[model samples]
Target: MADFVKGLFGGQQPAKVAIPGDDDFADYAGAPEPTPAAISSYTDAAHLAQPTGALTARPYTAWYRVWERTSPEDFKLEMYILPFLFVLILVHVWGTRANRSKAKAWSKAHAPLLQQEFAQVGFREGEATSDDILREKKADEYSTYATGRQNVAFIDFKITLIKRFNPFMLLGEYLIPLFFESIPAPAERVEATAYVFDGNEAKHAPQYGSGDAKKVSNSSFDGFVFAIVHKDIMKRMREDRYDISLTTTRDHAKLPVWTAVMSESAEITDMMLTPELIKAIHDAGDSFEALIVTDQPIDQPKTLDDTKPKKRINLSLKLESTYTATLPLFQLFLRLPDHLATAAHFRPEALRRIKQTRDEQISKIRKLDDDEKAEERKVAADKQKRELRDQKLGRLSAEEQRKFLEKERERDSKKKMKRSTVKG
Candidate 1:
């Protein structure tokens, strides 16, 4: 007890630690090295300690591997992502169906009213047409409008009940809901040739086709112009927020009746909608109305050389302008009584004169085309002749070759002139 107390207080302690020369350390040195058989057994035991199910698997399958490694959080995230996408797809499809239904209902209600209007104007519905018919009509309208011919005073109205959507393009709509909303809306287009009529039904009988075909061509010659624009355009015009311009053609012979912006409130009378004016509309190219909303007056200072200031002058008061053409004016012309009145002044001689001029212009165009082609052929022939002359010139002097080429050119020019005069 006394010795233990002394050791606790930093006195001499008992020798429990082993030194290097001790019996315990010498006994570990006498132990033999492991034999080859023992080493092999140890290695096999280590290999056996690893999992057998991992190496000799139940099956080589992705499902098993994923099942083993997939975390709870990963599974939860996948559940969230899938439902989100599914809901988005459902919303898009539902919206599209609703739009289509709405458009169909709108068309059903409006078509009857439109048909009645056409009937009042002596335009009978010829036939129900398909997409093919629409394409052909569009092509024909383009050609007639471009050429200012082959068009007659018949109104063609088309209503598309439903518009189809592209699946892939529609998927992108979700990225921008407001801007990319797809609506299978009903749409309508009306095309008519405004012409002059002398009111002689027999004399101005349909010249193009007969029956259903006749209705498709120059059947109606009531001498009134009509245009029912797109709904969007009508809305813009109603609001007085559309771009409109009226400019003459490059030749300055034709004047535009209307351009981009059309108004139902234009004060122009039906008498103004003449055949000549309608022809101008057919010939006018696309143009925009530029409006200067407001302009301020300012003072200008005049200077005299470097000596002194001369005088202060008042600049001209600037003007603010806005341009628009209204549909009411056009719509008025479509009325039956107004139409008949407008046609009262038109003479059959006027129609004959217009057609004659158109025919003569077309003939000139054909002749010009032929002359251009002939000139191309002559140029090619001249090139070949020059090649042959070059080969022959190897035996002649420079002066002789030059003279021969000059004579050849003169002969070709004379021949071209003779041909042109004969054709003319």
Candidate 2:
């Protein structure tokens, strides 16, 4: 008990008392060499000491090797690494290809889907389409609308579609939901052309086709030949909360009949059912069943009013300003109507004249360039001809050499045609 109490207070103090007086001093003074640590073999020793077994004195008959199996996390890490490495390769190869990659397939598929959705529920049911998107912009600044769609490509190996501006693009970019009735899938596009119309009517048409890209030859006319596929644009309007209102411009002289017909058209159709038309007649409460809208609201609820002078004046200050700004072009378009009607009838002659004008311009530029080069060569050749005269060889002037080259070119062209026929 005394020893136990001493050991607890100051660890094994008794070991010092057991040491011999001389040997204790020697042991403390002498230093021992550091032995190397044994490497772990995991193999069982001769008298096998199994981790989960009782110790045995008999020698081991066969070696028991322990295999360190891979953990669940190791497999998961490999799974993550392989796909990440594969996708990295695809992006480097596919993104910068000279031609657009297969991502266009999604563009082709989604364009029609968005088109159909926008076409449906787009405008008022019975309204005239003359006032399309452009007119709606004026009615109310707060009015939300489906604009247009654009397609763009971004890097990061992620080729997903993003929709902007137009809601149809949203449908077009991503896939349209399948619940909508089965419309045909959108078709593929082969080519697209921009109708590049500058002020020069003579050089209006420049056709691009499957030819030398750097120098495209002109076709008969400039018409964009994009993929000609059929897609539907549909819309459904809300029968409720619709009102018919007319905003008019008083200047009959300034307004074209077509423009006037379309100007107030969108608002007229914005809500076909006015507030008065949607009467609360439901027996179950203020719910609506049938609605009524009088053409004109008068002193009486049911009666149509015609006497009031409600002359709406849509101001022409801005419109007139724009016309005054481009009065010359506006007059040209006005005068163009009569000639345009005639132009449709004589398209072939117009095309020929336009072509002739373009060819003439190009030929003039070429002639000027060739003339400058010819003059420089002429000065050099005159010196050479004087040298040739000094020599004894039978001499011809530079002009004669030019004539000879032209004759040879013509002869070679004919001979080439003859050889092609023989080969055929």
Candidate 3:
């Protein structure tokens, strides 16, 4: 087309020009082709078969390799087994702990008794006042917290054993709370409060604790339970007043010296008074002037009426009628069974409740005693009656009532006839 265009222009076809070194067609003709580098890569593929760098396995295979990584000839069995064994042991320990916790939870599912028990032991949870300071101190001294904020304090309890020239102080007032062996809290305050045992339930049972068995003390002829209480009660003893004298019952007789009481306790439960203490009481005695009480000058109620009138002078030791008997009173009751203490310790309401239960037990025992006595009395009476009745009809069983009746009728008839003849 270019030559034809040139001929029409009268220029004839321009000569075709060829470059000196130019090829009109190259092999493959403009199609893309691989270079030598590509061919070499295919030929060099053999090198890729050998692992690169560390010659490491792929991740999954590497992880699986660890399970059987070592040969039996080189691997120590302990190394392989111990790690797994440790894991199993840890799991077992955790399981056991969990099971124990569950069991404890199940066991305590019904436990809501602490507050009630605190009330039982005379822990006053109510609002306390200055008058209660002594009580609070005593509670602080004696009360135990089982756990958390809960407290445990014993109530005032007393047992009256004997009727004598009444001793001024009861044993219960002097009884102290026992020292807890390993109490976890600190004692901020300590005081002793008067404890009186209600005797309404005194006839029931003695307070025989089942906590642990103890040896009987030969000196006191006391029971195992008494020993437990002895150590605790002895700690509460307060000495008599400075002015109180230990006067001798007999003139010039050697006084019973107060000796240190040897109670069976590693802690050395102290008896505050012995014969020596009595001597001290006497030696320290000072006469107190009696206050002259005038009724016209006094006996008026100031603001509130007190049931009892106050005197100008009151004795240091108060003697309330039927209030306290003495230490020996408790010793007397200590000889009784364990339930008596328990019976004595109960509150009036609680005592009433316990009475039904105790009565059931008492009823059985009482019947045995009553029945045996009744049987003996009946037998003796029957013999005595037979001797008297021998003059009347002679001895006979209850089954011979008809014969006795006939004999009685014959006698009555003879007597009536004689009386009728006398009248005529």
TM-scores of the candidates are: 0.33, 0.17, 0.18
- lDDT for residue 346 in candidate 1, whole number 0-100: 43
**For residue 363, what is the lDDT in candidate 2?**
67
Candidate 3 lDDT by residue in tens digits, 330-410: 222222222222322324553353344334445655676688889999999999987787755545666586778888899
C-alpha lDDT values of all predictions: 0.37, 0.31, 0.31
Q: What C-alpha lDDT, on a 0 to 100 scale, does residue 332 get in candidate 2?
A: 27
lDDT of 2 by residue, 1-424 (tens): 9878875576453234434667647666433456898966865585365554454456654344223444566689789999987876665444333122233332233234323323321233322232221112211111112211111000001122122233444456345435453442332211111111112223432222224423532222121100101112111111111111212222223222222111122222223212321121111111111111112121212211222122110111111112223223222212221222222222354335434543454566567668888999999999998786556233657787677668879999999999999999
What lDDT score goes with residue 260 in model 1? 28
Ranking by lDDT: 1, 3, 2
As for model 1, its CA RMSD to the true structure in angstroms is 21.7
Indicate which candidate wins on lDDT.
1
**Local accuracy of candidate 1 as per-residue lDDT tens digits, 1-424:** 9988885676764535555568767656544467675456447765778787778767666776886777788788789999988876776676556544443443343344333444222222352212112222221121111111122233333322212233444444344455633432223222332332233233444543355443432222322112222333333332342111111111112334343222111222233445643443443222112111101111211211211111111101111121112122223323433334333244556335434533454566567668888999999999999898778978778899888879989999999999999999
lDDT of 3 at 322: 24
Candidate number that wins on lDDT, 1 or 3: 1
Worst 10 residues of 1 by lDDT: 311-320
